[model samples]
Target: MSQKRNIFEEVSDEARDEQAVQPGMIDRGRGGARKAIRAWLMVLFGLVVAMIVVGGLTRLTDSGLSITEWRPVTGALPPMSEAEWQSEFDKYKQIDQWRIQNQWMDLADFKEIYWWEWGHRQLGRLIGVVWALGFFGFMAARKIPTGWTGRLFLLGALGGAQGAIGWWMVASGVTQGEGMTSVASYRLATHLGLAFVILGFIAWYAYMLGRDERDLMQARRAKEAKLFSLSTGLMHFAFLQIIIGAFVAGIDAGRSYTDWPLIGGQLLPPDMSVLDPWWRNLFESPGLVQFIHRCAGYLLFAFGVVVWLRGRQSAHPQTRFAFNAVFAALSLQVVLGITTVVYAAPWHIAIAHQLLAVILWALILRARFLSAYPVATSVRG
Candidate 1:
């Protein structure tokens, strides 16, 4: 049975035809949107770099444990007066880090470290507010793409978790040791790892979202399989190195064994057994930590070099450059690490070493991301 088409149906069909004839940009409005997203990402990137630097200083000055309490909303504002400062100091004194490790440490010294941790927390709060405001502004403007807002939300969630984790890290020392001041190496590693992951995610997403319209959905999504896997593997290896490096920092291992190429002129430092089960010493013993950091450094350098050469052969200059940057930055990181150790981890060199580690982390993250979607290789030509 054939049905006659009504005027309404005919007009609907015509409307559909008109829509189908619209320009590509009208159909896919990603071009301009991408540029705006990119500008946002650059701003975020700067914030993250600042966070990393402040965090490094926090770690360097042993100020990370200064703020014993975690108050999400109220903590953003620093203590208001002398009374407020004393009140905060009183709370800190109850913590084991004060009663035991830093016993008799005057209020003046306490204020010094407290201020650093306070600034770090305040910056964190500012970042949260800025991101929230910006995200809402973008959403209202309809600038964010579908499938990505959730990821951005995830970043915000991670920031929240980070604050909790920072407290979790501080709590460990408070419970076990008296004013011990030093936190567990593992906790420090976790803190650092989370920070790196969050920063990397922000950077990677920005790079993807900011490309020009003519470039957004081009040929690059093709090789996501192999390059992505390779870059991810390399990043994993680098993270392991970073964790080992933390172990070194935790025990102040650099101040002891400055000799390189071989730890103390031997494959392993002598008397490397203390924690009963032998393996435990690797975590608790300064000598073993130094030994591990040195070995990890070699593997990190080698792994990055291989990735660079391999990326160069893939016909993607960004991929190659990422690897090259990773290799070079890592090499410089090694030199800095050695100098830091040889000089007994002086404040300047120590700070530089930490900064370079941040740079190395950034490079490795770039390699992982660019490899996932190599822009140069996806040319439509």
Candidate 2:
């Protein structure tokens, strides 16, 4: 027995020596690719932020539905000639917005709105191309895990679905009577809500796969996961708020509630009973939609405050981060919502307000991810 070495143990040792793989094998090549991915993801996130802001602009400027058709493959190629421009306009002419509402509008005016919708579509298209190319490049270069490669692919697929949803949303207005100029409230909300969902998911997934949380302490990880879950819960609330907000925007609801802490100087707003039996009015009445959005804002801010107060004791940088990020963003968003109500939403201010929500949300997600995993550290004797 003393002269014998176990064959299995011998083989294991030989394999270890030959392969030279370490305990940190997963982290190998993760460094460069992770950095690259972070940089690229930051850019993608910025573009999404830009697209959202531009979308707000398109809405405020009343430029949506300018193009009037879904030409996914050919749409990528813009109007190149006068004839093509007229052809596109002719198609738009068939729609209710053009034929009934904007029939008197001239070509130059059409161009003004057309450019906005075109910019929106083109930006979305660019996001798709960049994400796909960067993802594939990283995979081929042996930078990211095959698992992540699959996830990124699915995200790209989501981008594709979003395009279809955008058209579906636009097609709603087209289906309405000849004088209607805007998409259905529900469709509008769906397109906007879905965009935020996809953006949030991408940001969260990036934080999960690419971020290294080794800087955090062990106790913090357990605590942060709970907080992260809470933060995620708040995000769900925020989304509902967005849909309510979209209903307001769709019906020009916020435009009328030009006062804070009250609606038209009243507690419950006058005439909230628009849809007969009262229940349906929440979605149908602009007053009710704005009112509900305001209530949701209060709830969201309150949740953030509670998460921060309860979790401040966790001995983790990210625990503090999780609480603070959500609190700060929630506070700011609440304020912005009020101002948008009071000031009637100046374009630049409104756009900035929306963009900050996205920024704070992504950071809050970072906090969540770090709290869950913490950072790996070596034991020191």
Candidate 3:
């Protein structure tokens, strides 16, 4: 039997090792530079949040129209000399905001407001530069993960479009004949809505990159589809509420009704139809706009509760904790919203409310990401 042994009966260890398959190109390079990419995204996220806060301050201080021009390239340097400052001020004087509302502002006053808007625009420029350098640097180094080139480029494109839209919003109020003192309410809402959208994409990408590619693949098999769907709906609802809040800010609606649970001591504000045309009241009427914002807040809170209940049933403790954080932020947001209104949207309270909205949005997104790629736990743990 030993003398007649077949060659297939046994194989050497080296032969077996030689026949083993290896990972393909896609698998081998699946998660390139994940940690570095996430770090870059987080930096962008912080800048966007700062941009939002500065923007809100500009609007509150009636300084958004101070620049009066959108010179994307040359605007980086502020007015350097008295003559340049005067020239810039002259351009601002042509706008209705100057003619109608800021007649009291001298050059010194103008400089103060100018600095606010200037800082906002400067921050925007900084974000663009950071994005460009990071993205191309990654590409040049061949460190970007597969399927991520287009995703990263999209951020820059959207940012460019946002700059154009910012000008569009400013143009609405810079007119000579329309008698406009501020940007159109709908345009403001549009501008703000896009910011939230951009912020959301950054946050989601960061969350995805937080885990290893193999881990994400395995986690996807255990995805809670229903919970993910619910969280998605909740995200949209929250975004809608943010847009409504922008409209409220656009027309100074928060100051119109300092009383909560009642508008001017009534369930509904009186004279909602005071604005021309029936539909105009929805966006143009302070009383009506604030009323709608209040109602939306209530509905958002209710929907959040339902989503939290669903999230609590998740099998993973990490997912459960994510949802709990979301619910906590949502509750704090509601309280801040009320405080903002009762105090008539003071700069401190209003800014705090807006900041909390950003936090809540990020938390909801984190919970949704967990639903899609939940972390696994052992029975003993």
Q: Model 2, 1-381: lDDT tens per residue?
A: 456667665556775688885655544544446667777777787788888888889888878888877887788888999999888788777778776678888778888989999999999889988988898888788787534676777778888888898889877787445567788888888988878877887787667545543332343445556666776776677777777877887878877678879898998978689687778788878788888888888887888787777557556655576667767777888888788888887887678777877776676666666566654433551
Lowest summed lDDT window (length 10), candidate 3: 22-31
The model with the greater TM-score, 2 or 3, is 3
Single out the weakest 10-residue window by summed lDDT for candidate 2: 212-221
lDDT accuracy of residue 96 in candidate 1: 71
What is the TM-score of each predicted model, taking all chains together?
0.85, 0.86, 0.96
Q: Pick by lDDT: which candidate is best?
A: 3
- Model 1: per-residue Cα lDDT over 125-185, one tens digit each: 8778877877788888888775667877887888888877877876766553443666777
- The deviation in Å at residue 265 for candidate 3 is 1.0
RMSD of each: 5.0, 4.5, 2.4
Error of 2 at 27 (Å): 3.9
Model 1: CA > 4 A from native: 1-32, 175-179, 212-216, 221-227, 377-381
Per-candidate Cα lDDT values, in order, are 0.76, 0.76, 0.93
The positional error of residue 123 in candidate 1, measured at the CA in angstroms, is 1.5
lDDT of 2: 0.76
